[model samples]
Target: MSTRRFFAVALVVSLLVAGVASYYASSHPDGLEYVAEQTGFIDSAEDSATADSPLADYQTSGVDDARISGGLAGVIGVVVMLVLSTGLFWLVRRRGTDDVDSDDARPEHARQSEA
Candidate 1:
């Protein structure tokens, strides 16, 4: 499949999983939090620096419905990750060239001899 089509399908699947499937997730704390609580150090854990962010605790702020809040947060998270990763890939990606004599494609000794 084409790259664009692949990415389009991936984005749709990611958004659907984030926005719809998240509602079925367990309400209990995740593994780390559960272990912390069992070990009696849960209270000692400090809030993250983003504790006051709108998406804190995987829920959007000021949203009445838990499902909507969590779903919104999940979708937002997926979008942010996709944008950041795509931009990074674009920035670091190799640009193809038709020139065979490019310095990078030449052996070190040949480049030194030319210089």
Candidate 2:
């Protein structure tokens, strides 16, 4: 499939999974957190540096409604991921050929020598 089509599908799927499916995610702690609690070390865990950030804890801070907060956080996360991934890919693709001579710019002598 074309690159545009592929990216469009990817964005849609990402938004759907993050925004909609996240609402149904289990509220209970997962394996690591559960184990920590079971082992009696859960209280020792330090809060993340981002703990005070608006989007911390998978939900938007200060939002009165839980559903809206989580959904907004999910969509924001997806958009950020897409932007970062695309930027990294673009940087990688542009790195190697920036100063290389194009076919039309090669000297006739150089071209003949390579031939």
Candidate 3:
């Protein structure tokens, strides 16, 4: 398959996995919350004052469908991380190689002195 088709299939597969994860996520407090509750600090957990944030509780602020909300957030997080990692790698990879000519390879000490 073409690169585009491969990416599309990968995305669909990732979303499906995330959807399943959302379906199976625990209703009880997670590790942090459980610790807090057991330690008698659960009351300290205040509502995020940023009520306007789109993702407050790993759920879209106003979304009512639990599965859809979590799945969407998971997908969004994955896509954002993929884009950021790709950009970082591209930047690092583009720093040298075919673009830099052999003639520009001045001695390291000389190059450092110029700066």
Candidate 4:
């Protein structure tokens, strides 16, 4: 498939998983939290600096519906990642050279030594 078509399909799938499948994710604490609780260190765990952020704890702030809030947070995360990754790729691509095999492109040591 064409690059554009491939990216379009990927983006659609990402959005669907983020906005729909996320609602079905397990509600229990993740591995780290579970381990901490079992080991009796849960009480010592402190909130992250970003605890007050709207998307903290995988739910949007002030959203009464748990499913909607989690889904929205997931979608926002996916979009942010997409934009950042695409921009990074664009920048790295711009710095690449089209020439693959050229003696002039290599350093002097890369060339065969004169007899």
Which pairs clash inside model 2? Answer: none
The collision pairs in model 4 are none
* Candidate 4 Cα misplacement greater than 4 A, ranges: 97-115
Task: Please give the TM-score that candidate 4 achieves against the real structure.
Answer: 0.81
Model 2: worst 10 consecutive residues (lDDT sum): 95-104
Residue pair clashes in candidate 1 = none
Candidate 3 lDDT, 78-101, residue by residue in tens? 777779988998987777554565
TM-score of every candidate: 0.77, 0.81, 0.65, 0.81
lDDT of 1 by residue, 68-105 (tens): 99999999999999989988877656333434437678
**Candidate 1 regions off by >4 Å?**
94-115
Please write out the lDDT profile of model 4 over residues 1-115, one tens digit for every residue: 9999999999999999999999998889999999999999999988999999989999999999999999999999999999999899987776554444454677777665632
lDDT of all predictions: 0.90, 0.89, 0.77, 0.90
Error of 2 at 11 (Å): 0.7
Please identify which of the two predictions, 1 or 3, would achieve the higher lDDT against the true structure: 1
lDDT of 3: 0.77
| Cα lDDT of model 2 by residue, 6-63, tens digit | 9899889989988889999999998999999999999999999999999999999988
What RMSD does each model have against the real structure?
4.2, 2.4, 5.5, 4.0
Better of 1 and 4 by TM-score: 4
Better of 3 and 4 by lDDT: 4
Say what the RMSD of model 4 is. 4.0
**Strongest candidate by lDDT:** 1
